[model samples]
Target: MSKALSKAKGFKQSKSGTYLSMATTAYGVFGVAKQVKKARREHDTLRLLDAAVSAAAIVTGLALLVRELKRLGDDDVLLG
Candidate 1:
């Protein structure tokens, strides 16, 4: 019973977390692109680099989150 409960919670987290990450990454990239474009149009190299750095950080964080979810291995459908 406890083992079943653990799996259920983990599976739920993996599904919801991935979907949330997708949405967040989509919006974040869009925002970053807009920022970079604006900075480029204004010939602001510093802000352009800043935008790039922030976008890279966001990607890294998402990668870590997905890695953690994979390590958890809570998806029964996937395991099966």
Candidate 2:
């Protein structure tokens, strides 16, 4: 049981898991873009600000995931 729990905890750092996270984060960016458009259409300053902040966070998360993926690729000893 402990081993299962450990694997589950570290699953996010795995290659496929990181790809899944990146995909979801990219989806979040699209959602944020929509929110920004809607907020601008209605002249909602607060909502626009919120969307901007969310977009920034999502971009940062994607950047981190990409870096992790690159690191994982570099660490693949089988390729060499």
Model 2 misplacement above 4 A: 1-10, 74-80
User: In order, what lDDT does every prediction score?
Assistant: 0.74, 0.85
All models, RMSD in angstroms: 4.4, 3.8
Which candidate number maximizes lDDT? 2
Clashing pairs in 2: none
The Cα error of candidate 2 at residue 5, in Å, is 8.0
Under the 3 Å rule for N, CA and C atoms, how many clashes does model 1 have? 0
The CA lDDT at 66 in model 2 is 93
Tell me how far the alpha carbon of residue 21 in candidate 1 is from the true structure, in angstroms, after superposition: 3.0
Clashing pairs in 1: none
